[model samples]
Target chain A: MTTEAPERRGARTESPAKFRGNPWSGRVSAIAYPAVFLLLVVLLWWGATSTGMAPPYILPSPEDTWAALSENGAYLALHTWVTAVETIIGFLIAAVVGVGMAVIMVYSRTLERTFYPIILFAQVIPKIAIAPLFIVWLGFGPEPKVLVAVLMAFFPIVIAGISGLRSVDPEALELASIMGGSRWKTFIKIRFPAALPELLSGLKVAATLAVTGAVVGEFVGANEGLGYVILQANGNLDTAMLFAALIIMSALGVLLFLILEVIERISIPWHASHRNKDA
Target chain B: MMTVETPSPSTAVETDTLVDVDDITIRFDSKKSSVVALRGVSLQIQQGEFIAIVGPSGCGKSTLLRAISGITSTTEGSVSLRGDQVVGPRQDVGFVFQRPALMPWRDVRRNILLQAEMRGMDRVEARERCEDLIQFTGLTGFEKSLPHQLSGGMQQRAALCRSLLHQPDVLLMDEPFGALDALTREKMNVEMQRMWRERDMTAALVTHSVAEAVYLATRVVVMGARPGHVVEEFTVNLPRERDYEETMEDPEFHRVAGRVRELLGSASSHE
Candidate 1:
């Protein structure tokens, strides 16, 4: 069995292009399809506004939205930075606290039973409903915004962390025990690394939610941010500015998500989702 | 029928006996009911012995192996290694499961070195031993490859290398090759025999294949289910370094294999 056929073994070692599961043609289509779809959507938007089918006040032209973006580039950049900082900070906090809580709960059934239901209850309550309460408590500073982002991002991380940490193979645990590994060693060496694929997936979801959270927090009470810009634009009927702000907000979320995907690739390249098709 | 005398508890603790499972019983309890997995099961393994346990699916053979490794506790009686009572997992034994159980994030070399890391062995020595085992198992070129990159047979070989990296005094395997195809399994059994002959180690394998038990083990233990216990034992009078085809064609091998099948047939029929 070990002496595999020379050709098969050579294919695995050299990984010739012809044998790759995902060929260059497949990859080209993967990117091309999405790009073409986006182009068509933009064209449709241009047609809608250019023909007066949609009024400027209701739906701004693509050119007008672009002009608004570049004109207020500096101002929008500042607000985007503010929102970005809040989202990143909140995500970091939630990542640490959520995973820590999950580890504790997994190790102790008593804690799991005690805290799991409460967490689920907290998650079920709409976070937006409590944004106003956060404003009252933390005042209109970025603290409230960051806190709301943390709340929005916390639940998925906790849920994913719990399941990921608990998803270790029983045989692996038995092997650890036979090696005389301490609980701490087993967790650090086995449970933690094994959980990365799931945990990172949760982070991707939380990244987008973090943006929504910060924006929602700004909506209730804030002096500056993309959310504040959108509100001001709405009051002035500057539909172009409103569209620009919404675009930037989504771009920020995608940027964060892409950064996480890069981290996931670096951290666990051996994961099925990250592994090269040839490998 | 062949009859083999059961070793008494006093004799089980003799210095030459590497592992002594002294009349152990295991039971699982739940909210609704209790299931007895093993009852009054005892076996003594001498130094440098290969013992294969064969039984039906629910016969608790795997449970018995786990009990010896101290991963599962016996409800009654005790297991001792070298005159010392087995309390928790001992550091000197190695275990292989049905699946390779390699860390998906780690490459073959690092996966095998996981044992050395856990035991805090000397880094240089561990690396050298890891290299040697990789070469010995015909995984020399694939050291840098991840577990997912390897074939099922190759993965199992890597697992075997990981188990043997520490040069453990005893190796316990629970259906290690049961997942492989027939040809691959036969090839692995041959390799396993070679590895065992080269090393001065005791091994206990739990498997469902009667031919496998007869092929690889010096002593084949047949167990019965529904409160599993030993029904009979067969001693294989074959050469230590067994060739795959030669052993399969040997009359003695066929005789042992046929008897084991008969015993298993009767054992399951009783259920």
Candidate 2:
């Protein structure tokens, strides 16, 4: 019985995570199919306009949008820079403030009980609705736009931080206690590190919304930015330009979101869930 | 990992009482229910005694050990170490839980040094101690390896090193080998006995395995279930310097082991 134990246990080395799972091509198809579908849509769009099914004003087609984007690339870039600056600054503020608030909540149970629901309530009040109110208060400057982004981005962070801080394994805590760790030491070493992976997940979601927040703020009250450019183009019936601006905004969101993911990969490399794909 | 080849074992050099856990009774009360974890359990652990406390699940074997280490407060008792009342965790008592409980973020070397850093030991001295601990544990090459990277046995070894690094007087282990394969567990048990004999450091291990208790303990305490207490204590008349096979095969070892198994079987049947 003991002799057989060695082989039985050794056999467990061939884990279920082996077999290379399904090939990466299955996943690649997910991305590839979307791209192909999008290309087909664009082709149909160009075909519709070329066949004069829709007027140039109604649907300007892909070439017209590309032409518009190329023509205003420098001007659009300037507007993009405004939105980018606002988004980054607002995100930084939200990150610092959110984490700070979460620390306070983690340290005190009373604060968590008193303020957590209120924070969620603040998050639920649509950011676009609040954007106009912020514009009314802070005036039509970029301040309101940044403030809107900060508000939109902060809730996810706070909730993430709270859950992460509270989600520490009781067993790990017992080990730390045995090691004679103080509250601060335990939080820094155990609670904080455990919370990190969860908090990053929240930050990624917040980043997507943060870009949208900037645009919404601009839409409410702005003389500049992609949102303002879209409004101006709409007023002039430049549907192609409006679409180009929208695409650029989405691209920016995707770019920023991917960057956070990359940083998460590099920083918390030990996390099993954060392991990179084989491709 | 606690592999101390004590060619000359460290006898209780300090002629002082190391631990005095007096008249402990632990109870839990909630709105709907009340659970008794321990009832009037009293124990005094001397220096350099490898004491194994055995019982069934929820027998308060863990609770009793917790009270001893000052990890859990006693409802109706006081634990004194060096004649000081233990209200909270003390810096000197090392605890090895059933789980390795190693930090996921840190590598094995860093996990071992965690307690040393917390105690404000000199960084240079701490690093030197870590080197010695790694060598002793047969983990010299696995210094930079993370916890997830190592085997379960290896991780537990690192955890042992972590607890032992602070050089506490008493090492409180709560079924530290409960999660290991039998072969690895046997190897660890042998290693642990060797270290205990070498260090002669006061230890209290809570285990369900009767064979393990008979093998490792100088005093195998069989605990009764459901509001547990020490029902019987067996003194193993095994040789002081134990060889693995020699001691297990001894008729005296079987007599003690059989008695413990009977006690455990009867205790649980009654509950």
For all candidates listed, what's the TM-score of chain B alone? 0.95, 0.92
Q: Count the backbone clashes (under 3 Å) in each candidate.
A: 0, 1
User: Which candidate number maximizes lDDT?
Assistant: 1
Every candidate's DockQ is 0.56, 0.32
- Candidate with the greatest DockQ versus the true structure: 1
Model 1 Cα lDDT, one tens digit per residue, A134-231: 99999999999999898889899998998898888888888888777788899989999998888999999999999998999999999999889999
Q: What are the fnat scores of the candidates, in the order listed?
A: 0.61, 0.42
Question: Highest TM-score among the candidates is held by which one?
Answer: 1
B1-271 in candidate 1: lDDT tens per residue? 2257344322445468889999999999999999999999988888888999998889999999988888898899999987789988777788999999999988889999999888888999999999888887788788888887787888888889888888887899999999998988887887789889987668999998888888899889888899888888877888888888888999989998998899889887887
* Candidate 2 chain A worst ten-residue window by lDDT: A1-10
Tell me the tens digit of each residue's lDDT in model 2 across B1-271: 1122222122334455667777788998899998989887766666777788998888899888788777788889888987889887666788888888888889989898888766667888888888887777677777887777777777888888888887888999999999998978887888788778776677889998888888988778777767877677776777767776888898988998998888788877876
Residue B232 in candidate 2 has what lDDT?
72
